[model samples]
Target: MPDTYNITLEISRYDPESHLSWVQTYQVEAGGILRFVDVFRKINDEQDPTLAWASSCEHAQCGSCGIMVNGKPLLACELLVREAVDQFNTHTFRIKPITIAPVLRDLVVDLEKAYDRVHAAKPYLMKPAPAPPEGDEYRISPETLETYVEATQCINCFCCATACISSHHHFLGPNAMMSNIVRLMDPRETEKKERMDLLYGESGVYRCHTARACSFVCPKEIDISHFLALGKEGKF
Candidate 1:
């Protein structure tokens, strides 16, 4: 095996100065063990210092380093360079900021709008069960919790939203709904009716057309289509 190889990245660049956007390509020398995020860092450090993107906790737990590579939205940190080349059968891959939002610069997208939907949906519990007295604690049986465990795994990366067909429009998007679903799944939550109202409203659950693209790109393997169905059926 060669010690190093070059990979080409076709990145979409937007210039705020002139209000122009274009695709620019860059080549990075990569080793076998590096990840896609590492390639971006190498580009920033060695090739173009002006390049911009967002990332935190590069461990794939923060969900901050989301980008579309080869027309698929997924976490950059979780995808390795070697795997991408092997799976797609090419060392050259096209990358751009996920759609359904405004681009700030290069790979950075404005997430506040999507976050607004999450906040509006009341992502947290309105009526959380109070802690038990003294040494006791509110508890849930494992069996009941198992029903919605996968839904609770959303990292809020907005990958699902980018993949959602209805997201670029008025729809609230899947990950945002997943946030609400997480709270609704809790047996201790008291406000099911209110949650249901928001989820079923216009631009709510029904907006999902069941394309299942969000579930396919989810790094957590969340059953997003099932959640959309459950929400539609008032089963949440």
Candidate 2:
């Protein structure tokens, strides 16, 4: 680990009833290997017990530690404090909490709306496969698997949704489009016509204006714009 450096975090605080919001600042010393989650945990333990945040898997698999770092959406668990210092050009870094939506507490934003939007897209396998062919298991070609590989990497973190200005204003979001594309691309799945109907219908894939912000903020680095492009071309 490299030498510890002092950093400052500016968190956005919200109160639901009063519609009041404020920013709270915390100073901490972090090493090169330390992540933003580590800084929050340390602050909660030593400085402010009320400092709130969320995390799971701690390894970036859960996608629970997503937050805004210097105005961009990022996975806190995957972001190193040293990298942040270098980006901001300071031993002391400024961390801004997400403010686009209702803050559940400190770093936590209410994802229920995002989840509802995902469910609205009906992102599920609608296949009617036989009973494993009675003996042999169903197999897929490597090329087919590779086609949907990037779409499958999405962890449903809502970072894409948050970064999508069109979704933020009038549409569902890139996550839903990506999910729909994954299902559409699956070889075993039938019902492409129905899925495409849903995607191009009202409150569907056509709502996306191709802002591409979703792709930029995707923690998994999923190419969301590609899915939108395919959708626009009627290629699923």
Candidate 2 lDDT (Cα, 0 to 1): 0.77
Model 2 alpha-carbon drift over 4 Å, by segment: 17-19, 91-101, 131-136
lDDT, candidate 1, 1-236, per-residue tens: 56676889999998888888999899888986788888888998999987888789888788888999998898888888888888778889999998867888989888786577778888887998887686467888898889888888788888888888887777888988877777788888888888888888887888899999989989888989888888887775
| lDDT tens readout by residue for model 2, 1-236 | 36887888877766666777788888888787788899889998899888778888988787677788777778889888888888767665545545345678767877675577778777887764553666766677898888787888888777777777777655767888778877888876787887887778777778887889888888888889888788778764
Provide the global lDDT of candidate 1 against the true structure: 0.84
Q: What TM-score does model 2 achieve against the real structure?
A: 0.90
TM-score versus the correct structure, for each prediction:
0.94, 0.90
Separate clash counts for every candidate = 0, 0
